[model samples]
Target: MHFSRVPVRTLDTDEKSVAQFGTEKMLESAVLLADSDLDAVVTLSEEITKATGLPCSTSTLAQVEVLKKYGVKRLSLTGPYVDGPMRGLVAFYQGLGYEVLKTSQMNERNNVVFGNTPLVRIKELIREADHPDAECIVVACTNWPAALVVQEMEAELGKPIYDSVCVTLWKALGMVGVGIPLFGWGGLLQDDPILKKMEDVLEILLTCCAASRTTLRLDFLQKNCHVDTVCAEACAAGIAQLKQILVQNDLANTDIPPPKALMDVYAVRAQMLAPLVRGDEIYGWISVHQVGKTRVWTEDEIGELREAVERVNGILRTAGWI
Candidate 1:
């Protein structure tokens, strides 16, 4: 829940320098927070696209998540970038399947000028960026002082105003299951019953993933190679398949179909395993089981298992484990 900001030592207006600075700062922040007691980190710059190998926008993926969370499809953007970086920003949003209705960029791209630009000027820019079909307006730079006026402007404009800094904060808080409804930050910061439930489910799954990883590692040390865990069972079957299930447990065979043996020992009837993957690299697998009689695996269960694995993958990325 604690935050520490480390300013990247580079001019915000210099696109190349800003990209490099963002990459370094992201790594720097991850390393710093990873060693501390903090559970997560949120990199504020949406302009830092180089590290993730994303086209155009650096923060587009995270922003897209924000958009998806709020069900916003079309966007109007106002930022302090010059023409060169501005094009990249627009392309980034377009690449993510969001319709960019209108955009306004300030002629002055100086770092100090952008950071110090008057709120009145930004209000005008927001108006210029507004469009009839746009669902939201994004103040697309972290350094630009937008948070001070976001909620107020949104009230006047009758549309959501998403400041990059606010979005980053909202996203970071959401990921950790802190759904506090803070006023003066626009609709994204408000409480959503659906999003809260989703966050609660995600937090539970993340906890399960961490506990599973820990249990597997501990069992690996205890068993001394040939880790007889749920994932190991799944790996024995096949990594390509999403899940491996043994519904009815027969306790006669303990060696073959290790999952069954493990299930038999625990008196479990059904087991399912999903691969934990980062890009194409398969780190390990995850599993779920039922202790009672045979149970049919539904499509929703399978989908949720996959989502749990992906959530674990996300945690791994944030922790620099992948």
Candidate 2:
């Protein structure tokens, strides 16, 4: 459905702008959105729809008054907001001389609230739907942020959720339906026929890896510096001069950098994986970052960071992210 997201500002300039309402400035913000393609406009439940719904603004009661004035009988009555506010929304809609079509019993404060499951709850709500007389469910209040959850709710409820945003999307997707599967909101959009297949495939790929979560990325260096390489080789050569010293310390080949570099090639990370292999075979793999966030890498934590990148890449490839 047409999901409408209102905007909230953060403390910084990078904050994303959205269509929102809270004060007179917010109400006047509509002029900015006059060219906006939003399907549903949201406002307070008690405030007159004449401002939002009818342009000049009118209350639900006043909206009915205006509709009656226009000889419009088909009132797609919705509301009660999430938790139905103080009273039952069904009663409120009935009071407006229109039939109650759908009610999500939603948590009305979805816009700013993090981690609310409008999808899961509405899925449960639609199971009890029964519509016989209304042309369409008016949906709940606009501010409820039920747009994403509406379609899946309708698909299951055997009737529409009639949300403002969802209705707008319903009108937009009239005959052609979208197939992208979203996980956070919009109920069945997360579990639609096609989305389930992809998520299932993605899950399987992830489960097939046993890599450490420490990877790194480095730049595409042209080659090892000649001066640095000469220095490194000379240092390794000096290890022989102190062979007696190493043996005295119970450390063999300890004076050389060659062995460490080989064991940790380019300081790359190695990960031993126990994937769900077809047989009992396991794989030990090494990976190179090739590019990274920083210009030069740090000496410490390099191995672990490199390993994490390997792990992530393997998972992505297995999941077809490559």
**Among all candidates shown, the one with the greatest TM-score:** 1
- Candidate 1 deviant stretches above 4 angstroms: 1-19, 22-25, 44-59, 194-322
TM-score of 2: 0.31
Candidate 2, 1-322: lDDT as tens digits: 2222336432111223223244555455543443464433333332323345523221243334333543543434433234434145557656666655544444444444423445555445444343555444444444445566554454344433345544333223322444333333333222333223333332333233221121112111222112112101001111110000011111122343233442333332332211222235322222212111112323333443334334444554575433
The C-alpha TM-scores of every prediction are 0.52, 0.31
List clashing residue pairs in candidate 1: 48-58, 49-58
lDDT of 1 by residue, 1-322 (tens): 5544555434444566667555566655555544554544565343323333222222444677778877998999889877767787888888888889999989665666778999998888999999989999988887789888886677577778888888877767666767645544566775444324434444454344321111111122212212232222111111121114222233243234644444545545445555554567544555554443455666665666667555655654564445
Task: Return the top candidate by lDDT.
Answer: 1
**What are the clash counts of all predictions, listed in order?**
2, 22
Total clashes in model 1, counting residue pairs 3 or more apart in sequence or in different chains: 2
- Superposed Cα deviation of residue 34, candidate 2 (Å): 5.5
Off by over 4 Å in 2: 1-23, 34-92, 101-104, 107-111, 129-136, 143-145, 168-322
Query: Least accurate stretch of 10 residues (summed lDDT) in model 2?
Result: 241-250
